[model samples]
Target: MAGGAIAVAAVGVGWLLWPSPSGRTLPPARARVYTEFSACLLSDSSGVSGKAAAPVWAGMQEASATTAGKVSFLAVAGPESESNARLYLNALVARRCDLILAAGTAEVAAVRARAPALGSTTFVVVGTGSSAGNLTVLPVAPPAGVSAAIRDVVVAASERTSPH
Candidate 1:
């Protein structure tokens, strides 16, 4: 019985230390994936929209490098104008993107309007509403380290609103 117990303990430890099936000490960071063959990136003229897309594309690129597939990008003008929004969305649909990265409130609204026809495509929005399907909303607020900046803005707004 003691010998059997020792054997079992050795087996458990061996399993715990075993490398993954790929024979690597660490698992791969990214997996190969398939989608609708294009990614539509919508950003506003203020450039915040483009900034928001950077991290996502970087992560995807890293994954593609480590895995067995490729990723593509298609960017469109996402200015505050409704006309620009319509043009951007139409172009994205024409490109047949499987994912849409909407960078602002206006872009989110425009994409939500056509999401039904988008048909299971994924939509990621930065700083926008929450009602659209397959839409993941990442809200942006002032960071904790920027409390002083926020206070300054509030004071400025109050001064403007208070009087002559």
Candidate 2:
């Protein structure tokens, strides 16, 4: 039994040391050259100055720092209504943002409603909600997760939307 145990241990260690079949070593970790992707953040009544939207804004800021792509944030400074939401969505599309980060239910609905007209821009909703084509809803809570989710969603969308 002891001899068998030794053999198993040796096999495990051997496997760990074994080189890959191709014999090509992995390159050192380096900063990635991400294709340029623009994003816009639309907040509700809180906008960027209020406590409610601060976490969301900070999260996006961090996400922007980690990527090579040019990411931006835009907070709607006025009260949120369907009409206002439409205006902001239209403006974001006009600004040529590939992704839109809608910060509340109102923003999500506005984006969802307008998604048909703007075919290419992907709307990533950062709060609890449902989504469809060109719209991805991520359930957000506690503020910190919002940033991480935003980064992940943006990265994934960038990969999908980028041409080969």
CA lDDT of each prediction against the hidden true structure: 0.54, 0.72
Worst window of 10 by summed lDDT in candidate 1: 145-154
User: Which ten-residue region of model 2 has the weakest summed lDDT?
Assistant: 48-57
Model 2 RMSD to the real structure? 15.4
TM-score for each candidate, following the candidate numbering = 0.48, 0.67
Write the residue-wise lDDT of candidate 2 on 76-130 in tens digits.
6576776777787788888998888777666777887888677777887765557
lDDT by residue for model 1 (1-164), tens: 99999999999999998878977676577755542234455655543325555554454444334332234554545347656676777776676555566655566677766676676666665564674566655555433312232223223323333334
Sequence-dependent TM-score of model 2: 0.67
Cα RMSD (angstroms) for every candidate in the order listed: 16.5, 15.4
CA error at residue 28 for candidate 2, angstroms: 26
- Residue pairs of candidate 1 with colliding backbone atoms: none
* lDDT of candidate 2 at residue 103, scale 0 to 100: 71
Candidate 1 ranges with C-alpha deviation above 4 Å: 1-37, 46-49, 66-75, 141-164
The clash numbers for all candidates, in the given order, read 0, 0
Error of 2 at 104 (Å): 3.1
